[model samples]
Target: MSRAFNFCAGPAALPEAVLRQAQAELLEWGAERASVMEVSHRGAAFEALVAQAEADLRSLMGIPDDYAVLFLQGGATQQFALLPMNLAAPGQGADYVVSGHWSQRAVAEGEPHVRTRVLVDAADAAGLYLRAPEVDAAAVDPDAAYLHYCHNETIHGVEFPAVPDSGAVPLVGDFSSTILSRPLDVARFGVIYAGAQKNIGPSGLALVIVRRDLLERAGQPRARVLTWAAHARAGSLLHTPPTFSIYLAALVFAWLREMGGLEVMAAINQRKAQRLYHAIDDSEGFYRNPVDPASRSWMNVPFWLHDEGLNAAFLEESREAGLLALKGHREIGGLRASLYNAMPEAGVAALTDFMGDFARRKG
Candidate 1:
């Protein structure tokens, strides 16, 4: 059977080239007689694979030598608690810019560990989550352990076009939805983390890039597995790690490099987003995207039809047309299209065409 265009929020689509390459090497990786997953994590072969994955990722993102790139188990949800445990001292507060569901959850997870101050929240007067609010530099507490924000809110389709100003406080970002889709200034952040299921490869792995000096702040005596210092010291080989996920992620990094790095990827992603958004904008009140124009996400586009009754027909016809996973989150019912790095321009074009046709038939 042919592959369909997938728009899942996570465990999302991966590059076809990466998938094919993995298939080719599934049984025997190079000269080794065993698959990558079967190999020992401490073995020379797996070590080399992990090292090369880190190197390629660093090169693609322009990660500096002072940063420690960790391929860790558990998803970004684990980082919510780990961030406060590692970065914040007892009773030390951390400023959080709550824009959407994920950011709010991060705050809730950190509250028991440390005092979480809401620097800015994006909910409107009606308490509806619509867009990311502008960061007020004056509201940011200078003495906070760090400032946390989500680069892109996958559920609400809100993205920060620029980094928030945190003054001297270290900036921590959750880039789960937007990582590798564009060029980023790695120096601007003290720590950046993402779950691999979206743009990278598969579920069960979280990638963390943290400045080396900040490792000293992981002073809280937590479990060995939860400490960033231990993971970094062990070279992310602590307790077996997610071998298969890391291997797949390595293949994806290689694929990204071959696709001309983030610069080329950014242009392609921008074009795809523009094309889809144009379709929504030109729908003549038939489709509406709730996010503010400035904060709209390039990765996730959530829209609602003027007549809500047509949603089921739209989804059913879209599935028949080979477009999968277009349903929006239950919290905010509508439709969403997740345009991650792996979604080709042709896929977006097809979706736009389908949208136009659906509107015409139902209008």
Candidate 2:
């Protein structure tokens, strides 16, 4: 049987070639004839793998020498708390621009650890997260430990039009959904972090890119394991790392490089997004995407049916047609399609074709 087109938000789709490579090597990885998971991270072969992975990532993203990249366990949610603990003093000010569910959750998680302040709340008059909020550079506190924002909200299908200006204050971004989708200006921000599941490879691993100088700050004391500086110094092998996830992410990095890196990816991703959004818009009363056009997420596109009663029929038929995981998040129920890098353009074409057919019969 053929593989189904998956549109899951996190633990999203991965490139078919990467999966084939992993399968080919799953039985025997190195000299010991052991899987990567069975091998010792301290071993030379696995250490080399880690080194190459970091080098590939650095090359793909054009990370500067002044920054350190750490691959650690726990998803981006853990970073919500760790960000404050590692970047700020006890209850020192940290400015957050709440754009959607994830950023709001970041504020909730960081409040206990740092002096959290809301710079811009994107909620509409009806308290709906249907639009992306803009952050003003002047409103940012210069003395604040860091300015925090979510570059893309996976749940709400909203994205920042561009990186918000932070001036002298260090800007920290949760780029979990849109990290490798396009080229980035790494030097513009103090730190950027993402969970591996969405665009990289899988869950159980998270990536952090931070400036070396920020690591020198006397942050709120915590376990060395939870400290970013310790992980950076130890080269992200503070303890038993998620070797399998790292291995998978490394393969993804190689795939991205072979495919011409972020420049190629950005064009492909933009085309994919435009095709899907156009389907939604052209559907007239048959479908609707509530997000503002300027703030629409290129990664996750959430939409609704004119007649909500037909939701189950649409999902069932789409599944039968090999389109899987089209259901929206439970928080805001409707339909969502997450177009991660690993998701082929053909998948989006398949989805739009299915959508048009469904709307015609069920409209």
Candidate maximizing lDDT: 2
* Residue pairs in collision within model 2: none
List the global CA lDDT of all models: 0.92, 0.93
Worst 10 residues of 2 by lDDT: 127-136
For candidate 2, write residues 34-141 as lDDT tens digits. Answer: 888899999998899899999999999999999999999889999999999999987689999988899999999988899999999999998888777777889898
Model 1 worst lDDT window (10 residues): 129-138
- Give RMSD (Å) of candidate 2 vs. truth: 0.9
Candidate 1: how large is its RMSD?
1.0
lDDT of 2: 0.93
For model 2 the local lDDT of residue 285 reads: 71
**RMSD to native for every prediction?**
1.0, 0.9
Candidate 1's C-alpha runs over 4 A off are none
